[model samples]
Target: MFFFFRKMNAVYLAAITAAFFMVACQTNPNAKKLDTGTEGTIHISVDETYQPLIDSEIKVFESLYPKAHIIPTYKPEVECFKDLLNDSARLIIVTRDFNQQERDYFKQIKITPNSLLLAWDALALVVNKANPDSALNMNQVRGIMDGTNKDRKWQLVFDNANSSTVRYIMDSINKGKPLPTNTMAAKTNPEVVDYVSKNKDAIGVIGVSWISDPNDSLSIAFTEKVSVVRLRADNGSDFVKPYQAYIGIGSYPLKRGFYFCLKEPYRGLGSGFATFLGSYEGQLIIKQFRLFPARLNVVFREANLK
Candidate 1:
């Protein structure tokens, strides 16, 4: 009888241990995988134009969650999209969302992507500190882009031939027209800035984030290297710089959407990072980068002085 009771107790203990592990597995399905919402490692792609801002975001996120590791590949926007489509990356940060065709393809594959608008980013036109032509209207910009601006014959420089900044100029500014023969590709934003800084006649077209972070020493140095051009809207009378308030109010002429598209089927690190970007803390970081935070509500009050 003692032997029988001991055997039964051992069986019960084994069953209870098994049940406990089963419940744990059910509670955290990601335990079997390497990644979860708040833990593990993941690879993501980001547009090189937003490298500065996204770098800061990742640093903070990883610091807060020590076990979460995000490896980001910064490349052209088109390449980032390619990484997403090819499953090379679980998340991508770019200036636009998936088009209808991409959506349809994902639907066909039974994958639903989560795309969130992160912020409003602006393209900053930078010129040499010696260059006096710092302000331009919309028409003038169109002329410069299309090689029709005989007024100054300014040499146009872009970060990359396939970069979002180039696409923005072609689509939004040039109205789908081809870039002029004079437009040069500098490979990266910093190179564009460097080129423009050395060439008085060259204008570097880059994302505002490259030079917007007042707290970053590199950003401050970039700002000091070149003069950011003020842009007058097509209809507005005032020429405004790419300040956060200007971007928020649509006063900045070269503003574009910043977005994060996650292709995670589960609530993994990609989703977690995406949620963080739209959260108050993430939006605050975006604000610090000087981009207009789309997820945060900011009130602009008018104050008058006597």
Candidate 2:
């Protein structure tokens, strides 16, 4: 009888232990239930430089589906990447694609992030309407960027210290050289336009969308305040602004590709939004903004008058 009781007690304890672990395994304390992506909410990070265009896209996306909720956070390019890598954000929109090292790191973690080319974005240089010089070549821009130019009267202003515009100048144009000492950093793109508008000598580097679409009120206001600089080609033959034709034809020297990187493993909200962004409607929105759509064909119409 004593042996029988002892064996029964052991069996009871084992059953209890198994049940505890089973419950714990089913409900992991740290595991969050990711959204199904169709009806639930999700957060997306976008580069601050592309706010005007991305904001318009989101407004249309949410209006089509009443059940879905999307919260967009706009920050500097580097911080946007940080939010994505830390899992705070499942999607990120910015310039450029992932490098080999980034791909390898994602592979190690068993996550192959998918990306889409959304549009061709260009950095536009704006100056006060009062400024006499409205055209600049790569050399003049480079000189202003690095503070070695003969024209000390021109002051360079950027969106912010961490903006992709500054990164592009430093990494691509200046070959990783330091920025000029006379540079100013504004809190946002609108501020850049405002500063340039008020200061005759201030030359602001900004994303073209800030002043591209005439339909947008902000863009109209921006155009009223500043003059978009016509950039001279390296060969010195033609001068063009960040107009759609120039960006599409690859003549705009300060242009970059806007892309979205999504890391959702399942067909969640991320997958749905990514599909939408590359779809016809999304591309249309991009076209309306006057940027070059990456996934769609853009037709320019001209009437010949004899």
Give Cα distance to truth, residue 157, candidate 1, Å.
0.4
The residue-by-residue lDDT of candidate 2 on 1-306, one tens digit each, is 999999999999999999999888789887676676567899889899888788888888889877788889999988887887889888988887777887898999999899888999888999999898998899988888887788757888999899888888898788977887878898899999999999999999898887876476432233778999989878657888887777888888888888998888788887888888899998888876767888987676887979
Off by over 4 Å in 2: 1-34, 214-222, 300-306
Query: By lDDT, who's the top model here?
Result: 1
User: What tens digits encode model 1's per-residue C-alpha lDDT throughout 100-143?
Assistant: 99999999999988898989999999999999898999999889
Residue 58, model 1: Cα distance from true site in angstroms? 1.0
Task: Give per-model TM-scores.
Answer: 0.88, 0.85
For every model shown, the clashing-pair count is 0, 2
lDDT of each: 0.90, 0.84
Query: Candidate 1, 9: how far from true, in Å?
Result: 14
